[model samples]
Target: MLLRIFHVSAASLFWYTAWYDQNFINVPFPNKEYAQYALKGRVTFLTFWCLVLQTIYFTLSVLNDYIGTNADQSKHASLLRTIKDTLFVLAFPVALYVTSAFWGIYAVDKDLIFPDWLAKLVPSWVNHTMHTFILLFIALELVITYRRYPSRAVGYSIVILFNLMYTIWFHCIYYQTGVWVYPIYSVLNWPARVGLQLASTSTALGFYVLGEKLNDFVWTKVHNKMVKSN
Candidate 1:
């Protein structure tokens, strides 16, 4: 219960900071470009989904407690368990990837990852809120909870769909404004653009598989301990 609340709170806080900075503190007034604010990019999309996933889990927890299920592993066909499994399976990799991509790019050239002008407005703490601590929060959740992963087909399908959607969205944005969302995309020629996109998609797909394997490993140990206790 406490951990659920903490997860919900942390996700909520990240949303607050993201919106407050964009809608309130941004210079020259609030950002009016809806595409710029759209949940198309990784950071915003993942953060948004984290809040959603946490909220759903929190509500499910409350519902279970109210109905006196109390975390029973065998109840209502494990509906809550299934939902949480899918949620974490999808969310874990994305959150980890977001943090890794940010720092990885930041290390190479901060400008490529984050445009300097917007980057200057954001403090290190805020940057970590979206990147670093988000990963930590998900990690803590993983350490405490055992998630039963769905099949690899389901997991890989979702990842592919998500990456495709975002790629299309960026293309649409470019079509609409004759400018790419990230400056890096604008400089790339057709072949280079395709190559970069493929590399990124492959990286995300790798993370999806990694998350599944990690979940299986963790929960296998947890289940073993539970069996031994019995």
Candidate 2:
């Protein structure tokens, strides 16, 4: 329960900071006053409500899984496979967005985004470099998935649709309120924005296919080693 609450809170906080304050591109340190403002505007209201729905969805899903009926070994295996497939599909674009945003923010000003408390404890470069590397590793992992799920046409289609919807919504809101959620998106002219969106979507889809392969390789190797030891 505590963990769930923490997750919900953290997710809400991040969304609020990103969507409401237009800090999505440059994640702010917790110490910044931008973190404390209450929600405002149509976009802000919509985002907050969507986050609430997401929290409910997560809660119900977890509860359902915890109390759901038992299954035979084969059924369990099939369910696990479905989950792996879904993750493999989703991980690609997620990794790309994460990495791209990391670089975008770092390029602007590395220290501004560091967590306030941690800022004093560690060097800014360390934080910046670590974040960059972690994002890159996630992208690499997404690439690795391709070896396992070589045919992810359905996944690619879903990702493209999702990105298109997101772009439309984001552009509409930005135009309506003259507020930009992400700095990278905000700076671009219409043509550039379109190009970036296309590039981002394509890269993400590619990464998703790659991620599935990497997951299979890692798990298979682990299983083989265990069997040999026994």
Candidate 3:
């Protein structure tokens, strides 16, 4: 809807601005002029991804009856799932905001004027690791839900469709503006970028399958143990 459009537009903007200003425009893709959109580009990129993730989760929930299931289950399991889900949902957007804000601050004050302790704590490595973990968690959750309702081919279809659309949208934007929201896309040429996108998407699907298997395995084991104790 309206939110989705805004998110995609914002993420696209942020992504282009970050790349054009940081690296792309002056050197290889010099002909590609995007400075006009650079200021809002980073914000756009972040917002788009946030919306994408939220849409994915919401769609999945509706498809899986999560939104309409029995109230009893909610009373029993809602708290734990809510905490994890909220964190999972918030993690990426927060990271993007922090990164954008930091870059903005740095742009204004060329020198490292922030408190030494705070500056030291926010290492690039840590940020990278955290982002990776959050993305993995998202992939895992998707996989788990997929496993929970494997019989529903429609659910899988929706997931596949969404992922494909996202990939296409990402590549198209990168090509048009010469900016990549994720480093993997930016570092690779077109062929490589396409290959990486396909591989990453497949890997995420694989992780989802693995998560489903693990959940099944664990539940079976726990059930057997309980029966034995009884």
Candidate 4:
């Protein structure tokens, strides 16, 4: 109960702040006030969506625990947890991978990607909010609660559909604005773009599998410990 409430509050606060900064304060593009990036940004946007998903997830969980009937609670809880896990599995890798990729590119040619000018506009805390802390929050959720994953067919299908939709979104943004939202995308050839997106999709799927395995491992260990104690 406490965990769910905390999760909801924390996620909501962080995302609201981020949305404000991204839309109002940061304004990455100069002379383009009111030209909010919206859907055409980095993986951070995806992370934001995951945060929104979790806020609802935990909110529902709280209701399920306190307000829902027992039998109904289990059904609702299981479905909500599976959805939360799927969102995390997708958000975690993308956040880490994007952050790592940015640093790598920054180290070599900072101007190419996260140039110093832009970095100043996007402060460290904001960066961590969108990138680093996202993974941490998701990890905390997993540790505090273990939920059984749905079958791979259902889980992977939902995840893959999201990735595919995002891919289409980025392409549409490029067509509309003639600007690649991420600098790294600009450097890639068509084949490379295809390859990278495919790799990202595969990596996200791999993380989902990892989450399932981790859930099983941790819960099994916990069950054994409980049994031994008894």
Tell me, by TM-score, which candidate is best. Answer: 1
TM-score of 1: 0.77
Candidates' C-alpha lDDT:
0.65, 0.48, 0.44, 0.62
> 84-184 in candidate 4: lDDT tens per residue?
54555555455555555556676898798656777777777766665566566666666666555668898788778878887887677677677765656
lDDT of 2 by residue, 91-127 (tens): 4455445556566765788654444654665455434
Most accurate candidate by lDDT: 1
Candidate 2: where are CA atoms >4 Å away?
A: 1-88, 111-151, 221-230
Position 35, candidate 2: lDDT: 36
lDDT of 3: 0.44
What lDDT, from 0 to 1, does candidate 4 have? Answer: 0.62
List candidate 3 segments past 4 Å from native: 1-147, 152-155, 183-187, 221-230
Report the alpha-carbon TM-score of model 4 versus the true structure.
0.74
For model 3, give the 10-residue run with minimal summed lDDT: 66-75
- The full ranking of all candidates by TM-score, starting with the best, is 1, 4, 2, 3
Better of 3 and 4 by lDDT: 4
| RMSD, every candidate, angstroms | 4.1, 9.1, 12.1, 4.6
Candidate 3 vs 4: which has more TM-score: 4
Residue 148 in candidate 1, Cα distance off native in Å: 0.8
Q: How far out, in Å, is residue 22 in model 2?
A: 15
